[model samples]
Target chain A: MKIVIVEYGMGNIRSIVSTLQYLGVQDVVLSSDFEILNSADKIILPGVGSFGKAITQIRHRNIDNYLNEIVLENKKPILGICLGMQLLGNSSTEDGNNKGLGYINGYVVKFDNSLVKVPHVGFNQVKVNNKLKLYNGFNDIPTDFYFTHSFRMKSDVEINQCYCNYQEDFVASFERDNIAGVQFHPELSQTNGLKLLKNFIDKF
Target chain B: MLRKRIIFSLIYSDGYFMQSRNFRLQKVGNLNWLEKNYRFQSIAFALDELIVLNASKTEKNITEFAKTVSDLVNDVFIPIAAGGGIRTLEDAELLFNSGADKIVLNSLLFQDPNMVMKIIENYGSQSVVASVDCKLNLGSYEIFINNGTKKLDYDIQKYLIYLEELGVGEIYLNSIDRDGTGFGYDFDLIKIVEDITKLPLIIAGGAGNENHLAKGLQINKVSAVATANLFNFIGNSIPNARDYLLDNGLNLSNRVFDTLDLI
Candidate 1:
C-alpha cells in the first residue's frame, strides 16, 4: 500500500518512516504535496513538538488546506500520532490557544502537574475499546503503549475511545469514521505499538 | 497504571561502540558486531526504551555519530534517546532527524543552560532528557559534566533542581564510581537526591543483573533502570533478565506480540 506521512517540519518523521518500512510497506512517502497526499492509500500524521508551533507550520505550508480536502472531503483514512493526534482536535491549550483541524470534536489541555508528573513519560496501559477498527484483533484488555506528552484530549461526543490513567483518566485513542488518532507513540511502543500500527494498515 | 521501564543504553565512541567504566571508554565493537550479536530486531523485544549516547573524546564528529544512531535504530522498535556532545540546535536536529525520539543532554545542562532551554522551547520538554553524571565525594554527591571528566561546581541535588527548572522531561542519573563495576546502583546517592525533583528518574551506571535492575525499579521515584554493561547483557542476557523481571513482577511491559507477525 502507498503510505504518505504528512511532514510539516515538526516531529519524529524518521522513526515513523522506519516503522512503516519495517512493516513491509514498499511505497511509503514523506511528502505534503497536494497530489501525493490525496492519492495515498493511507496517510499518517506523526509529530513530537509544541502543538501551537506545529499548527503554525501546517498552516504556513498550506497542509491544513490540503488535509481538509483529502481527509475531510475525500474521506481517506488518516492516523494521527501524539501531537498529530492533538492537531486533529478542535483546539489545544499548548503554549497558547490555537486552532486544530477540528475533525474530531475534542480539545487539548495540560495535565495537572500537582497530581501527576508533567510530560507523562514512559509506558502506560491503554484501556482499549476493542470494538474500534484500530484494535480489531486485540482482545478486550488494557494493553500498554508509550506516552510522553503534557497535554491531553477530552471530548463529550462519545466516539470509540481508549483511555489511560496517569494523573487521572484521559483520552488515549479515538476513532470517528475515516479519522483516527492515538495519543501514544505506536512507532516506539514495541510489539503492542507495532500491532496497533498493523491494525491501522489492515483494518483502517 | 504507568509502568516502570527497562532502558538498555549503548555507548558509541569514535567509530565503535565502547564499554564505559568509571566514565572511561574501551572499544568493544562496531555496528556490525552489535547487529550480529544483539540483533536489535530480536533483543529489542526485551527493552522498554533504548538510549544511544555518542561518547567520542577526540574532537567529536556529530554527523558520524548521528549516522550510527540512524543505522542502529533501523531494526530497534523502541523509544531511542541519543546524545553526548549535543552542543547546538543543528546537532540535535541531525540526531532527531536520524531517528532519535529524545535528545540526551549532559554538559549543556551546566555549560549552556540557554541551549537546553532553546531545545526545550523548540522541541518541547518531552523531547529533552537531562543526563547528570554524579560521583560520591566524602558522603556528598558531586555533579560532573562534559562526558564525566570535568567536575561541576554545583552539587548534584542543586543541579537536578536547575535541570527541572529548565523543563527537561526526565533525569538520567548515572553514578560514575559504580559504572561498569557490576556491584549495583549507588543506592545511597540515589536515596539522597531521588526525591529532589518530580521529573521521571532513570537510574543508570552499575546494573549488572536483573536483580540490580529490580532494586532500582523498586524505588518509587525511579521511573526506569538503565544499564550499559556490555559484558553482562550481550546475547540471551537481555531476554533472560526480562523474564526474571517479569516473573518477579517488575511492572515492565508484559504485552507480547510476534515481531514477525506485525508484517
Candidate 2:
C-alpha cells in the first residue's frame, strides 16, 4: 500500500518516512501535490511549529482545499500528528486566535503557565482509545508517547478520544472512522509510537 | 502521567564521536564504530531522547554535521535534538529537515539573540532548546559559550532568567566541571537554578551509573537526566540502567512492545 505524508513545508518529514520504511512499508511518499495525496492508500498530515503559520502555509498551497477533496470528499484515512493534529480542530488560541481546518470537533488552547510548565516536552502516558483502529494491540493500558507542544486540543464530542494528563486531562489522541489525530509524535515515541503507526497502516 | 526522561547524548567532533572531559574532547570512534560497539538503534528504545552535538572545534560545517545527524537517527524512534554551529535560520531548517525533532543552540543564544528569536518565531519556542554550559568558579557559577571556551560575565541565574524571557522551550544545563567525570550531576547547582525558570530543565554531564541517574531524577525540579560518557554506559549498559530504574519503581515508561510482528 502507498502512503503519502502531506508535506506543506513543515515538520520532520524524514523521520516519518524512515519509520515507515523500517516498518516494511514499500511506498511512502512525502508530497503536498494533490495527485500524490489522492493516489495514496493512506495520508499522514505531519506538522510542527505555530498554528497560525501552518494554517497560512496550508491555505497558500491550497492544501486545505486539496485535503477537503482527498480526505473529506474521498473519505480517505488520514492521521495528523502533534501540530498537525491541532490543525484538524475547529480553532486555536495560539498566535492570537487562529482558525483550524475544522475537520474534528475540538479547539486548541495553550497550557496555563500559572499551573504547569509550558510546551509539555518529553514522553507522557497516553490512555489509548482501544475502541478504535489507531490503537489496536494494547489492552486498555496507558502507553507512553513523545509530546512537545504548548497548545493542546480539548473536545466535548465523542470522537473516541484518548486523554493524557500534564496537570489536567487533555486529548492525547482521537479516532473517528477513517479520521484520526494524535497530540503526540508517534514517529518520535520509540516502539510504542511505531506500533501506533503500524496500527494506522494495517487496520485503517 | 508525564514520566521523567533518560536521555543519551552523543558528542561528535569532526566525523567522530568524542569523549569529553571538562570541555576537552577526545576522539572515541566514528559512526560505524559507535553502531558496532553500542548498537545505538537497539539501545535507543530505552532512551526518551537523543542529543547529537557537533563539537567540531576546527570548522563547524552544518551540512556535514547534518548528514551525520541524519545517519544516526535513521530508524531510532525518539526525539533527536541536534545542534552545534547553527548560526542562521537556514542552518536550523537544514538540521530539522535532516530528521532533528528539535534544534539545540549554544553560542547563538548569546552571540545573536535576534537569530535565536528568528528561529523561535519560525519553529515556535518548543522547537528551540537553549543549551547553557556552566562551570562553578570560586564558588560562583559562570556561563560559557562557543563550546565552553568563552565564559560570559553574567552568572547562571541571570543567564537562565534571560533564557526564560527569551522564550525557549527547554534548558539543557550541562555542568562543565562534572562533564565526563563519572562522578555525578551537580545537585547543588541544580538546586540553585531549578526555581529560576519554568521551562523544562534537562540536566546533563556527570552520571556514571544508574544510581547517579536515579539521584538526578529524585530531585523534583529536573525534567530529564542526560549522560554522554560513552565508556561508562556501553553495550547493554543503557538498557540495563533503564530496567534498573523501572524495577526500582521510578516513574519511567515501561510499555512493552513485544508485538513487533503485528504489522
TM-score of each: 0.99, 0.98
Give candidate 1 misplaced runs (Cα > 4 Å). Answer: none
Quote the positional error of residue B170 for candidate 2 in Å. 0.7
> What is candidate 1's lDDT per residue for B1-263, written digit by digit as tens?
99999998999998899999998999999989988978766887888999998898888899999999898778787899999999999999999999899999999888898988999998889899999898988878888888878888987667888889989999998999999888999999888778698899999999898899999989999999999999899889988998998898888877657776777
Please report how far candidate 1 places residue A50 from its true position, in Å.
0.6
Pairs with steric clashes in candidate 2: none
Off by over 4 Å in 2: none
Tens digits of per-residue lDDT for model 2 on B91-146? 99999989898999999999899999999999988899999999998898999999
What DockQ does candidate 1 have relative to the true complex? Answer: 0.85
Worst-scoring 10-residue span by lDDT in model 1 chain A: A159-168
